[model samples]
Target: MDAPERHPRIVVGVDGSDASIAALHAAGSLAGPLGATVEAWACWDVPPGYGLYLVVGIEGFEYAARQSLEQALADAFGPELPAFVHPRVVRGKASEQLIEGSRNASLLIVGRRGHGSLVLGSVSSACVSHAHCPVLVVHAPEEAAHRKKGSHARKSDDGQ
Candidate 1:
């Protein structure tokens, strides 16, 4: 007898930013109708420069990172995640880890900007360049607001 096929996954990079939250929603929306799973990924890393500081309390850092991922997932979805969605916290650079995790995913989703910058974030840029699957970069809320304001301004100018 043949084994049953597993459900496909829609991988998403999440970091508690407004953009990441948007990406999570996008992934969930896509996963629902497709009967796919949503993998919410978050990575935490400490450079060699911070080793001394980390050595004093590495366990705490790990705990906090895991908590952050869990909290982000809860905040985006709810206290209880849907059966199709799950959260994972990995230890590595965001871009590299996310790229590796999305290898078997049907779609890889990320926010255009994370907590790092006002513009496009490095992780999103790296994922766009090197993801194994199709990539979807969701825009930040502020960017949507800006676009809306710009369109309204254009309409006023046209009316003048």
Candidate 2:
């Protein structure tokens, strides 16, 4: 029979952005020492007022989310993802799905602003405020994160 299931689970919210990639890496690095499994979630949904266009269905959005998740995983853990990492793509508000996932998780991890504004993202904020478990918000490395956000951060404040 299989070993008894571990109670430790790390749920990470990934949106294929640099920040999310950082979160995945963080979860991976921590999972082993903690004897936990990482669940990386990439969630997507149709924008408001796009119901007409979406009449065809939601497969496209779901597919894109899956692709993003895969790419992010590759970026985070290289070509071969860690065996302890279980990735998932779900259709719903990220914050809600992540919160729901946290119900049985020991930890919930999210990027500070993956595919979002400079400050704390709506999804991250919601997770911090409502997730059932402890939350860790990670920020991506400087260059990649800022580039994806459509801006840049100077290494020196003097504008060198």
Candidate 3:
């Protein structure tokens, strides 16, 4: 007979950023308590101009992106991990893919910004706006912590 179904499933978008790493950690912690499995998704899209001219085209880009996603998961999860976790990489608009993936998920997590971002990124904004499930926006730690650490470092450097 089949085994019993798992509890809540979480979907997290990982783009290999600090915020995304934090989100993944948060998701894993939450999953541990809830007996849930995490579906780590990384989305990519071909660049509009140069990408369109490539001989390998969008499919090749997507394949490479999937490999990158696997590498990111390996970096995050490391070896000798349990079997409950899953990772997927899809090629499409990040927001749309995440929203679709989270339809059956209990929660969705994503970083505030990813590569090629100068400000609050668009994907996080879109997921918060559109995800069917509860959304978690993992931001960097409080500025006060950084300030305290910086002050401590400066004081030590001055030897005072």
Candidate 4:
């Protein structure tokens, strides 16, 4: 008898940014073809200046982070997120959390740029260098459109 196939994990980093939203959709699109489960991780760090305030404010911080992750999903996948995708909010650095998650995941996906930068974000750079699994950095819409148009031009030149 054949062994049952194991469901693979596709972990994505979300931060309520356009890039992250794109990554979420890219993960969902890939999971459908690969028969994998999508795990959305949102990380938040308390400001260093808040010492004792950090303890008292932890709950509120976590709540906001969780809500942001939920909203990103809602924005990406409409009112209800797909059943195969699971959302998680954790307290930690975004890069560290995502790298840890990559340990057991089949694929790790992130956006080329998150909420922080006009250029590539630090988390994406770290993931590319350190994730245990294969990493896919989804580009912003403008970049994707440019890439698509370039590829189309190349294909047309072949006269097929």
Candidate 5:
């Protein structure tokens, strides 16, 4: 016998950043029209110097991730989170977890950039390159870009 049908799922990375918030909104918009369920994920992992941090009582990684997830959802959906949207906190690398999630998702959505301290490509870039499903990279809002430029201009003017 054939397997029963399932609703399409859209996986989006939620990192509590404005760009990520935009991604969540975009995912929600798409989900409604596509009849897909949006799965918003906030992923976290131990830093490289985990041994030292562990001694310093940095064991609240999961809690912190969950907090970010909640905040992002609130920012994206206001008081009422859409019924089609589900929030999740994952304990792993963002790119790896999102890529794994893509295996079962109809679409993978992410921000164009994130607040990670990566020396190379950002998580969205990695997801675009590696996700099993089609990936959508939502850019930071125009006002944010303008604010960033204005701040840079002020700093440069002061330096000059």
Candidate 6:
């Protein structure tokens, strides 16, 4: 008899940045091996301090943000990925949306910003701090290697 099905859901954040794309790739690799469902999420919102807020209104801003989110997901996932990969778009603070979604996810994944710092973007930092599940901060392999080399060089120079 076949074994019972067991698969965890992995959540990932996408924002069209190289970092986000890297995160998606990492999540896909893990999902494929683990038989897990990959949920690609993108969150959108207008900054509250913009003067255009009065003209755009909350509902209007939400509508635009949602549309952008949908387009972003479509562009990122396209039509080639497996059916088990699901795409989601939400309107709200990225951190809040990600943390809430993490409630049911087995793992969360995000990319390190292009600046190559552990200081995550606002959204990623929040997820790292508060997500209920394990979170993987994806970085380009070259970046990881570079950081390691830099650290080693510094240690050698210090003679300690």
Per-residue lDDT value at 45 in model 4? 84
Tens digits of lDDT, candidate 4, 73-101: 99899997799999998889899999999
Quote the positional error of residue 42 for candidate 1 in Å.
1.1
User: Residue 148 lDDT in model 3?
Assistant: 82
Report RMSD (Å) for each prediction in the order shown: 2.9, 5.1, 5.6, 4.6, 5.8, 4.3
**Model 4: which ten-residue window has the lowest total lDDT?**
112-121
Clashing pairs in 1: none
Candidate 6's residue-wise lDDT over 1-160, tens digit each?
9998657999988776667777877877788788899988877777778777767576776566556545545555665756877877677788899999999999999877735454677777888999999999877567778889999999999996
Query: Could you arrange the candidates by TM-score from highest to lowest?
Result: 1, 2, 4, 5, 3, 6
Model 1 agreement with the true structure over 1-160: per-residue lDDT tens digits: 9998978899888887778888988988898788999988877887668878675866665677778778778777888788888888788898999899878888999988734444567898898889999999998778889879999999999995
C-alpha lDDT (0 to 100) for residue 17 of candidate 1 = 79
lDDT of each: 0.84, 0.88, 0.79, 0.89, 0.87, 0.78
TM-scores, each model vs. reference: 0.84, 0.82, 0.75, 0.82, 0.81, 0.74
| Candidate 1 similarity to native, TM-score | 0.84
* Tens digits of lDDT, candidate 2, 1-160: 9998766999999998888998998898899899999999998999788887577787888999999999999999989888899999888989999999999999999998735454678999999999999999988788456565553344344465
Clash totals for all candidate models:
0, 0, 0, 0, 0, 0
lDDT of 5 by residue, 37-98 (tens): 99999999888867876777765988898999999999999989999999998888999999
Instruction: Quote the positional error of residue 27 for candidate 6 in Å.
Output: 0.6
Model 3: per-residue Cα lDDT over 1-160, one tens digit each: 9998858999989877667767777887888888899988888887777754477556776777777666667666776444667888877878899999988999999877633543457888888888899998887555337658999999999997
RMSD after Cα superposition, model 2? 5.1
Candidate 4: where is the Cα deviation over 4 Å? Answer: 1-4, 114-119, 143-160
Cα displacement (angstroms), candidate 4, residue 107, comes to: 0.5
Residue ranges of candidate 5 with Cα displaced over 4 Å = 1-3, 55-58, 114-121, 143-160
In the predicted model 6, the residue pairs found to clash are none
Q: Which sections of candidate 6 miss by over 4 Å?
A: 1-6, 51-54, 57-79, 114-118, 155-160
